[model samples]
Target chain A: MTERTMTKADLVTSILLIVFSAAVFLISASMPTMAEQNRNPLAAPGIVPGFIGVVLFLLGLAMLIRSVRRGAPAFFAQDRGKPSEVDRSSWGRIALTVGLCLLYALLLGRVWFPLLTFLFVFVFVTAFEYDRKAPAAGQWKVPLFAAILAACTAASVYLVFQYLFLVNLP
Target chain B: MFEGLQLFGQAIVSTFTLRALFDALWSTQLGIIIGMLPGLTATMGVALLTTLTFHMAPNNAILILICMYIGAIYGGSRSAILLNIPGTPANAATTVDGYPLALQGKAGKAIGIATTGSFLGSIIGMLAMVVFTPLIGSVALSFQSFEFVWFSIFGIIICGNLTAPKDPLKGWIAGFLGLFVAMIGMEGIHAYVRFSFGSTNLSGGISLIPAMVGAFGFAEIISVMRVERYEVVKTKIDRVFPKLSEVFRYWKTIIRSGIIGTFIGAIPGVGEDIAAWVSYDVAKRGAKPEEREKFGKGSIEGLLASETGNNACVPGAIIPVLTLAIPGSAPAAVLLGAMLIHGVRPGPLIMIEFPTFIYEVVAMVLLATFMMFILGLSMVRPLVKVLQVPRQKLMPVIFILCVVGSFALQARLFDVGVMMVFGILGYTLREMDYPMAPLVLGIILGDILDKNLRRALILSDGNLAPFFTRPICLALFLLTMFIVLSRAKWFRALLAKIFRKNATA
Candidate 1:
C-alpha cells in the first residue's frame, strides 16, 4: 500500500480498530460475574478488559478524526513517491517460501526431522535462487551452497536441540 | 554489608569453575552470532537458549542465559556499524554514528570503541545490580497489591511514551490491545473464562513465547522480504583496540551513558533502545559545538554513549527481575520465565529463599562481559562477513528457526499457529507505525495488573480509596498521570515556555 498521509489503509485500519474495540467491550460486558464464588463484585472478570476496550475505542475514534482532518482526497490520491505497484515475481517468491514453510511444519511430526528439514531448506533455497536471474555460474554455485547449508543446518539442529538440549523437535 | 561481601566472595568462587567459564564463553559467542544476524534479537536469543539449558543446574543455566542476554545486546552493534541495519532494536541508535564510521573506513575502530563501551557499561550495570537488587527487593516488601497495580500501569504508560515519542496514541492502543489479548484467558480470582469465544485454546490464554516469536521473528521476516536490499559498505580494518588516551577522552561520555542506561533499565518494561536514545541525546547535548556537529557523522563519543547505554541496560534490566519478579525488558521477561521454569522464584522473597542468587547473577554478568569483550575483538572479521550473506537465504533459515523456537517452548503446534497470527498482526501494526515494545510489556504485565487490582479491591472490601490513598500507590498513580499529561500539547507548550524563560535569564 502507498504511504500517503491519511491514506485508505489508515482509514480502514482505524475503522477496523473501532469495530474490534466495540466487540471487545460487548463481549466483556457479557462475561459472567462471579457472585456465587464469594468474590468481590468490583473484581469482576471483565473490569480490566472493559476499561481497555473503552480506551481502544476512544483512541481509534481519535485516529479516525485525525485521518478525516487530513484532506479526504489524500485517501484516494496515490502519490508516485510511494507506489503501490504489484511486483509479481517478489509476491510469487514470498508465496512459495510461505508454502514450503507450511508443508515443512505439516510433515514435521510424520517425517524424520533431519531429513525433512534438509529437504525443505534445499527446496526453498533452490526455488528462490532460480526465481532470480543471476550470472551463469550462479546456477551450480547456488545449488552447491544450498545443499551444504541444508545438511549443516539439519545436522546442527538435530545435534543441538534434540540430542544435547533434549528439545523434542518434530 | 558483611553478609553481602561474603555472598559475593562465595559466588565468585562458585561461578569461576571450568564449566561456568565454558558456558559463559560459548554462550556469549552464540549470543554474539545471533545478535549479529539481522532479524534476530536479544529476547529471541535468550528464549531460544532457555530451552537448551533446561537440564543444567540452576546457577549454570541462569548463567548461560545471562551471558546470552548480555552478548546479544552487545552483538547488535556489529551489524549496525558494518551494514547500517541494526541486528536488534536496541542497536538502532548505534547505526547513526556506527555506520558513518564505516563510511569513513573506520569500522574496526568503531567496533573496538563499541566493544569497550559495552564492557564498561556491563561492569557498571553489574555493580549497580549488586547494589540495587537488594535495596529494591527490600523496598518492594512494602509494595502491596495497590502499589503493584499502579506500578504495572506506570510501566505500560512510560514504556509506550518512550517507545513512540512521535505518536504515543498508537503505542497506547497497542498496549491496551495487548491487555485485552491477555484478558482472553481464565480470570485469576474466579476461574471464569472471559472471552474465549468457546475455544479451549483461547481459554488458556495466548502463550507468551509463540506470540513473541511471531511478533519479532516471523514479522521481521515478512518485513525484511518486502524491502529491497541495500549495498553494504566495504571498509578496511586498521585497529581493533582503542588507545588508552582515546578511552580517557570519552570516559565522561561512557560513564554518563552507563549510569543513564542502568537507571532506565531498572524501570519496569523500559529497555535498551530507549536507554540508548536517551544517552545519545544527552551526549550530543553535552558535546562542544564542533563535536556536536559530528554527532551523527561518526563521533566516537556518540558511538560510545549509544553502545554503553544499551549494554548497561542488560544488567540494569535484570535487577528488577531478581528483586521484584518484574522484568525490565523483553529479554528479561523471557529470562524471568526461564527462572520460573528452573524453580528459581525471584521476588521480594528471593533474598530469604536464595540469598546467594543475586551475587551469582552479578558474577555471571561480569563473566559474560569479559567473554563478550574477548570474542568481540577476536571475531570482528568473521562476524562482519555475516553482512555479506544474502537476506533471501538467511531470512528463510531464520524463519525455520523461529518455527522451532516457538514450538520448542511448549511442544505445541497451536503455539506455532499463534506465532503465525501474531507475525501477520505485528507486521500490519508495524506498517501503521505503532510501537511494539509497549504491547509486549502489556502482555507481560497484564496478569500482574489484573490480579493486583482485584486483590487490592478484595482487601479493601470493594472500596477504592486505598488504591488512591496508599503512599506508594499514590506516588505511582501521580507519576503515571504526569507522564500522560506531559505529552499534552498545552503541557508541552508550557514546558517549552519555561525553558525559553530559563535560557533568556
Candidate 2:
C-alpha cells in the first residue's frame, strides 16, 4: 500500500503486537521472579530471555505509540508496487509448499529422497510460473531439465554421503 | 614486506597443486552458476557443498567454501542484469542501473561492463586480503574476548546503521531482534534456554542456513509471485563487453569502487551487499551532474560501480575471516563454520599453528576471482537474452531451482518448511517497508554477539567500563549511537537549523 493507501491497519497491528508481547513477557517474567523468590535464581527458567522480553515489549510499545501518532503513511512510504509484492491470496499455496517440504523431511528415511525432492522442486517452480503466452517448449524445458538435474544430483549426493561417506542424512 | 612476499610465493606454490587450487577454481565457477540462477543463492550453495567437503582436507574444504563465496557474490549480477531480479541480496544494488541498461537495448554492453567491474573489484578485494590480513592480525592479536564482544556489537550496529539509514531505529530494532532470535533455543554460554517457548525445534534455536535461505530466497520468491507481473524488462539480444576506452574513462570509478569494496569487506560482520549499495550510491554521488543523470536509468558508470564494488567486497570480507576468525559477510560466516568443521581455527594463532594458511587463503581467493571473472563475463550476453523469455515461462524454471536450492540445503523437507516460513515473513516485512538486510545481519551475526558479549563480560569481571573506554570500542559505540540518533526528526531539524544559522552568520 502506498502512503495514500495506508489506513489505520498498521496502527492496529502495532498495538496488538505490543499488547501480546507484554503479556508474554509478564508470563515469562514470573518464571524468573518465582525462581528468585525460591532463592534459586540460577535455576530460573528464562531469566535472560525474560530480561530481553521486557526490552522487546518496551520497543514494541514504542513502535505502537510512534505508529499511532505519526500515522504510518507519513512515517513510512506506501508500498511501492514492485513485482515482488506478496499478498494474502498466495498464503495457501505457500502453506502447501511448506507442508510438502515437511512431509519430505519426515519421510526422508522411508522414502526415496531424490524422487520426493524432484517433485518438490518441479511442483513449486511450475506452480509459480507466470508466463501465459503461447506454449513455449523451452520454457517448460527448464523445469524438466531442473527436475532431471535435481534427481540426479540428489542421487549422487545420497550415494556419496550415505554409502561412501557413511553419514546419516534425513 | 619481504617476508610477506616469501609467504605469498610459498602460498602460490602450495595453492596451485592440482587437487588444491584447480578444484577451488572449478568449484568457484559452479558457485557462479548457482548464484546466477535466480532461485539459488551463495549461502545455500556453500551449505550444501560443505556436506560434500566433510571428508576433504580442511584446507581444501575452506578453499572450496571461499570459492563458492566468491562465485556466488559475482554470480548474482547475472540475474540482476538480465532479468531485473537480483539473484542474490548482494546483487540488489546491481539491479538499480543494470536492468535499465538492458531495457535500453544495451544489455550486452551493460553485462560486459558489470563483468569487468566484478573482475577488477574481486582482484582489488583479493589484493586487500593479501596485503592487509597480516597487518590486521598483528593488531587484532592485542584484542581479548572483551574486545571481541564490543567488536561484535559494533559490527551489528554499523551494519544496521549503514544498511537501514532511512530508519536507524528500525535497523537497531531488527538487529536486536535477530540477536534475540539467536538467543532462542539454547544460550551459547550457559545450559539455559532463552526463548524456545516449549517447542523441540525451538530448543535448537534457529538454523542459520535455513533462516538465510528463507529470508533471502523464499521471501524474495513469494514477494515476486504475489506481484501481478514478473516481466519487468523486455530487451533484444545484443553483444556484451565494455569497450577499452570506456574502461580507461572510468578508471577512477573502478579504482574507487574497488577500494570501497575492499575496505568494507575487511570490516567484521558487514558483507558485500551493503558494500555494493554504499559504493553504488557513492559513485553516483561522486559523478558529475551530467553523468549522475544516467544513474538509475542504467549508465555503465553505475553498473560498473556496483559490480566492481560488490565483487571487490568479496576479498575485503575474506580479510577479517582469515586473519581474525570474523566473517565480513554471511557466506564468510558459513565458510567459518566449514573451517571449524575442517579443524582450522582462524585467529591469531593461525600463523603459528598453521603456517601459510593465510597464504593459501589469499591464493585461493585470487584464483577464484579469476575464474569468477572469466565465467561471469561469458554468461552475460546469454543471460541477457533470457530476459525476453516471458514471465509465465521464466517463473516455472525459477520455481524448479527454488525447490532444488531448498532441498539441497539438507535433503530434508523440513528445510523447505523453514524456507516457506521465512519466505512469507520476508515478503510480509518487505511489503510493510521493513528492510530485510538488518534481519540478515542479525541472524548471521547473532551468535557472534551472544558469544562474545558474555565472554567480554566474563573477562572484564562483569565490568562494563571497557565497552566505553577501549579506543576501537568507543569509536564504534559513538558511531552506532550517532547513526541511530541521526534518523530522528529532531536531529534532522536541528542539523538543518544549525546549518541555516551558520550560513546567515
Candidate 3:
C-alpha cells in the first residue's frame, strides 16, 4: 500500500480499536470480583483484561496521533474522486475462495467427508482455471483434470487421516 | 560433561534404528517439498503435521517435526535461487544474491553453497542448543511468579519491537490483541469465564492448533492465490559442490553469521527472517570493498550468510522452547504446542523430568542436518518439479488439510470455524503491515502472563514491589522500558544531541 493509503487505514483502524478497547475495559470492569467467595481481589479475573484494554486504548491513541501527524485527514479529503488502485480480480478470487471454504465448513458435518472434499476441490480448481476467452469445448479438459485431482486428493486425504491416523472424521 | 556425552551417545544410538531412519527420511523429504513450495511455510507444515502425527509415539512424532522444521528452512533457498521467490519468509534475504547468481547461470553453485551453509549453520546452532539450554533451564528453575510476569511481558514487547521495525505500535497492538484472544475463555486460576458471551466454544478457549493452522496455513493460501504467477528461471547447473578452499575462504563469515543467527533465534519471538537480514547486513559491512560491491549482485558471501543464518535459526529458535516454554520463532511455537499435545511438557522442570530429552533433540538435529545436506544437493532437480505444480490445483488440497487438521484435534466443528476466523483476521492484519509473529507469540505467552501476574499479586498482597525490585525482574523491567523509550523520536534526538556535544567537547 502507498503511504497515503496506509495512513488513511491507520486513521480508520485506530478509531475502531479505541472503541473496541473502551468496550473491553467497560465489560471487564463489570465482571464479578468474587468477594463472596473470599477470593483475593488482586487475583480477580478482570484485572489483566482491563489492563490490556487500557494498553490497547493507549496504542490506538498513539496510532491515531501518528496518522494525523502524517496528514491522513487531508489525504482522505484530497484523495476523493481518484481512481482506486484496488485489484478487483484479486478480490474476486479471494471472495470465491472464502465462499468455497465457508461452504465446505458448513457442509462438512452434514455430508460424507470424502464426497464433500471432492466437490470442494473440484469446484475450486475448475473455477480458478476456467478461461473466459476460451471456447466451451476447450474447457472440458480443465474440469476433467480438476475432477481427477479432486478424486485423488479426497481419497488420499481420507485414507491418510481416517485409516492410517485413525482420526474419526466428521 | 562425560554424562552429557554419554547421554548424547545413547540418544544417537537409540534414534539410529531403521524405523526411525525411515521416519526421518520421508518426513525430511516432505519438509523439503513443503519448504520449496511458496505459501507452505515451515510453521504451517509443522502445525498440520502435528495433527497427522498425533497418533504416533511422542519420540517419533517430535523427531518428524524437528526434521520437518530443519528441512523446510533449508528447502526455501531453492525457490529463492530458481524462481526469485523465497519459498518461505526466512529465505527473502536469500533472493537478493541467490537470484542474481541464478541469472548469471550459476544457480547450481548457489544451491550447493546454500545447502552446505545450511548444514554448517544447523550444526553451529545445535551445538549452542546443547550447551545453553541446560544452563538456561537451570536458571529458569529459580524463577518465581514475579519474574515470570516480567518474562511474559518481555517476550511480547521484544517480539513486537523487533518484528515490526517500521512501526512497532502495530506490532504491540497485534500482540495485545492476541493476549486478549487468550483471555476469551475461562481464566486459568479462578475458572471464571470472562469473555465467553454465551458461547460454549468461547468458554473453552480458542485451540492453538486450529488457530495457528488458520493464521499461517489458510492465510497463506489466500495471499498466494491473490498474486500473479511466477516463471521459473531455467538454468543449466554444472556443479553441485563447492570447493573446500572456496568455502574456507569465508570461514570467518560462516562463523560470524552462525553466531549472529543463533543469538537472534534465542531471542524470544524473533525468527529466521530477522536473523538472515541481520547476518547479511553484518556480512556486507565486514566484507572487503570489492567483495562488498558484489553483495547484491551474485555475491556468494551474501547468499551464504543469509542461508546459514536462517537455517541456524531453526535450532536457535528451539532453545527458548525447551528451556522456558517460550517460542523463539513461529514454527517453534507450533512445536511447543505439539510437545504439549504429545504429553511432553517443556520448561525449566524438563531437566528434572526428562534429562535425556534435550540430548535426544540434539541427536535429532544431527540426523536432520545430514539428511538436509544430502537431500538438498542430490535431489535439487527432482524437487524443482514440486515447485512447478500450479498453485490453483495445490491450494485446494492444502485447504482440505487445514479443515481436517483443525477438526482432527478434538473432532469439533468449532475449531474449523476458529481456523476460518483466524485466517481472515491474519490476512487482513498482514495487509495492514502488522507483523503476525508478535501476535502469535502473544497468544502463546498470554496464559503465562495472566496466570503469573495474578499469582504474583496474590503472593505479594498486591504490593507490586517485587515485580520491580527482584534482580531478574528489575533487569527485565529496565530493558523493556529502554526498548519502549528508545523508540520515541524525542528520546532518540536527545541521545543524538548528547553524543554530538560529547564529540565536540
Highest DockQ among the candidates is held by which one? 3
lDDT of 2 by residue, A51-117 (tens): 4467557666766677667766553454445343435656655565545445544555566656665
For model 2 chain B, where is the 10-residue window of minimal lDDT? B391-400
* Chain A TM-score of candidate 3 vs. true chain A: 0.93
User: C-alpha displacement of A39 in model 1, angstroms?
Assistant: 3.2
Interface RMSD of 2: 5.3
lDDT of 3 by residue, B57-82 (tens): 99999999999999899989999999
The TM-score obtained for chain B by all candidates, in the order given, is 0.95, 0.85, 0.99
**Candidate 3 backbone collisions, by pair:** none
Listed models, DockQ each: 0.51, 0.23, 0.84
Error of 3 at A155 (Å): 1.3
lDDT, candidate 2, at B454? 56
Better of 2 and 3 by lDDT: 3
Model 3, residue B358: distance off in Å is: 1.2
Tens digits of per-residue lDDT for model 2, B1-505:
8998899998888787788757876788778777776656776677656756667777787778888888888878878977788877789999999888878788778877887888889888778777788888888878776566666567666766766666554555566567666766766655556566787667766766666666765565555454455453666657665688987699899999999998887775567888899899999999989999889998888888998998898878777777777677767766776787678888777777876888888888877777776776665545544444544344433443444445554465555566667766776666666665567656656666656665665567667898889888887788766765677789999999999999999
List, residue by residue over B124-204, the lDDT tens digit for candidate 1.
998998888988888988888888888888888888887788878788888888777788778778888878779887888
Model 3 per-residue lDDT tens digits across residues A1-170? 88879999999999999999999999999988887799888988899999999999999999999999999999989989998988899989888888898899999989999999999999999999999888898778999999999999999999988878888899
